[model samples]
Target: MQIKPLIGALGAELLDIDISAPLPPDTLAAVRRALFDYQVIVFRDQKLTLDQHKQFARQFGPLHVHPYILAKPLDGHPEVLRVVKEKDDRRVFGEKWHSDVTFLERPVLGSVLYAIETPSKGGDTLFANMYMAYETLSDGMKAMLEPLTAIHETPVPEVDPATGRPLEPMRLVNKRGEHPVLFTHPETGRKLLYLNTTYVTHFKGMTPEESRPLIDYLCEHATQAAFTCRVRWAPGTVTFWDNRSTQHLPINDYHGERREMHRVTIET
Candidate 1:
């Protein structure tokens, strides 16, 4: 039940508590509170089964079934994504900076990722605080962006010989949506810089070419070291991050080794 802040920016590690067992109402409330207080929370030396993991995450929100088939779900667990990087694979999932599922009408609230097995040297995840990203902007910049809306989009996936084309999450739904460029946190009532490297296409009326300069500048500005924290993974580490307030980048330095993790998305 002890909380240790990992860095000055916005991450913390929970100590002396096992999440596998059923938690009391007050304890669950405290954990949820910590999520808002510190945008990311890491717990080490924990053991949890697939059901146990989902059970704990469901306390926060209903599980999200990912619209894109980026990774296969574990057998019999439709809501859990198996994030595995094989030894021969060149690409690692989530290598760029992004908040989860921004293209959707309602993006997910948070994510809980549990490291099952990790590489010997590197596969850390870096999280940058968007609240800081927005706060640090100049007053003129904030005023200009506060009322603007932006577009978020995901193109159709390429077809493979074996797997086939995958999409239309239980419904052939919208591929693009217009979302407010300036996001206000529902619970905390704080503003955040909502632009992401992956899904954000452009400002509502501008072309991609016209938007690049401002977008590039903001991307470079938001990810500065002062607003970021890195989380190194261990075999039994569990991490929960608030997607509304942070964007994450996964380091793909372990080329020859494998890293396996189980992730659940919380759609509040």
Candidate 2:
């Protein structure tokens, strides 16, 4: 297997490794190392069945089954989590920058997504390099944030369609969880900016008024266009991303077009 870096920021394209066929140990090691360095790795042009996909994902770590969630379980394969957007469904998964499944007490380490069906255009996934996001921070900002902890939650801001009246205010659960604004990657041992605009409500000690400017500035810095890499999908493509060092946004630009992918996440 050969891995080619896609861009200077954070992604790679792997060549000659077929997901359907069993991967040899050395080949898997090379792929794993590339993922650690690039934070996101893409495998192109190989169609992977549900079983084959899950098998490859298992080589990384134990699969994480989301707690407190229910889905139409995929037949015969409990490890493969399905993601589908029907013609009428406007919502797309991963629409915001996040560490996958971080609302859980223990966050997932990484994720593998294989595209089964893709739209002709505009259903891209964008990834940001959190390590670079942290490295670029001013020394002063870094020092100030090192001792701070921010809350993380999974609250959808949308209205409750079931009620005709306006939806009740949604509360961000799991509040007051202190995470360093800067987190160090476990495997690579590199520091990374760790806050998410969607999950982070406020800093630990500051009032909302005090934290607004600092939090807003960090968010904008982390998501700058220069720091992001966008991936356009094709059928039979597989993308594996380390959740510890990166965040992603799935574009909702492909309305009325069918897009489907199966996901398997590694335990943190």
Candidate 3:
């Protein structure tokens, strides 16, 4: 497969590889290397069945079932999560920047998302390179963050009064964990800014009010355009992202259009 860098920040596009079929050992190695180096990889114009998508993701690691409290599993495939936005639906998922499932003690390693349907305009995903976010910090800032731990937690979802179901399909059980503010990547051994606006509520030993300024500053600094790449989706496009080294946001600009995607998460 030919790998082309998508932007200077953190994404690459893989061309000429059919993910539906098993990859040769060398090709798989190359793909893994590209994923580690770039943090996010995209494959466009490829069609894959739900099974094929799960199979491809499993090649990297065992599939992870999202805690049902967070998202319901897709029918017949407990490991796949369906992300849908109806034409009239007002809510959106992943609209805020985050590393998925960080509240778990062992967060997911990565995620594979295949676009089955896409809006006519304005449903792009943005990824920020956390490695860059950490590396560019002043030495004093790095020193302060290196030894600090932060709390991550998902908010409880609101139930709809009419249906008695969650207004959204997902809910967080309020799962919480403490993770290093500057996390060292398991494979690359590179340090990354690991907190997110969505999941990280505060620093371990501080009040949310006290943590506000620093958290807000880091969130804003880490996602500056210079450290990010945007991916515009098309039907049949598949994107794989390393959750450990990057944070993503799904732009919800297409309010009245339909978009659907199937996702599989890889266990770390």
Candidate 4:
């Protein structure tokens, strides 16, 4: 099976790899290497069962479960996360920029998402190349951020699904961390803009007011079109993205329609 890049600009064009079958040795190696280089890879038009999806995800590493999710657990399989958006109950996930499960000390390495049920139109996932975002930063901007650290916190009164109640702050542990302004990827040795608005409430020393402008600026810069890629969903499509070096936003374009996907996040 030969690997073809999907788009002229971004995304991988996978040719003739049966995701339903066991990945061949050479094909698996090629896919792994491509993920590190591209940060986002897509396997188009291969429908696999829930079990097959879980099996393929484990080939990379252990999965990272969402720490704050109060609803249905991943069935003791911490890796598998169910993203379902039904008509009466519509909870859109990851609409904001985020690196998955970054509240953990050792963040998620990557994620594999399978589109189970997709709307006819709309609902695409967007990924930004943090490596490119970092490389293009101005010298003065880099210098200003070198000493800073962002405080990532999962606040109490969580957003509840049923009745939309904000749950009381559970006693939080390992809920916050000081991530460097610039983080280097372990495998590729590439620097990336390491901030996520959802996880990062403020910088270590700066007040919310003081940190707002610069933090917002960097986040906007990191997700600029020049360093970004968008993937439209199809039922059999699977996307594996490097969580350590990429930020993602799931477009909630279809409100009334059902949009469900199965996701497994590899541990970092």
- Please report the candidate that would top lDDT against the real structure: 3
lDDT of 4 by residue, 3-63 (tens): 6665443467567787776687887888889898778898889888777888898778876
Clashing pairs in 3: none
TM-score of each: 0.93, 0.88, 0.94, 0.90
Give the per-residue lDDT digits (tens) of candidate 1, residues 137-228.
99999999987787888744444212343443533244776788789899899988998868887898789988878888888899999999
Model 4 pairs in collision: 4-13, 5-13, 6-12, 6-13
Error of 1 at 114 (Å): 0.6
lDDT of 3 by residue, 1-268 (tens): 8999999998999999999988899999999999999999999999898889988998999999887454657889999999888787665776688889898888689999999999999999999999999999999999888878989997665863222455665444567888999998999998899998888888988999999899999999999999999999999999999999999999878977899999999998
Model with the higher TM-score, candidate 1 or 2: 1
How far residue 62's Cα lies from its native spot in candidate 2, in Å, is 0.5
Q: Tell me the alpha-carbon RMSD of every candidate.
A: 3.2, 3.3, 2.5, 2.4
lDDT, ranked from best to worst: 3, 1, 4, 2
Error of 2 at 50 (Å): 1.7
Error of 3 at 129 (Å): 0.2
Q: In candidate 1, residue 45 scores what lDDT?
A: 93
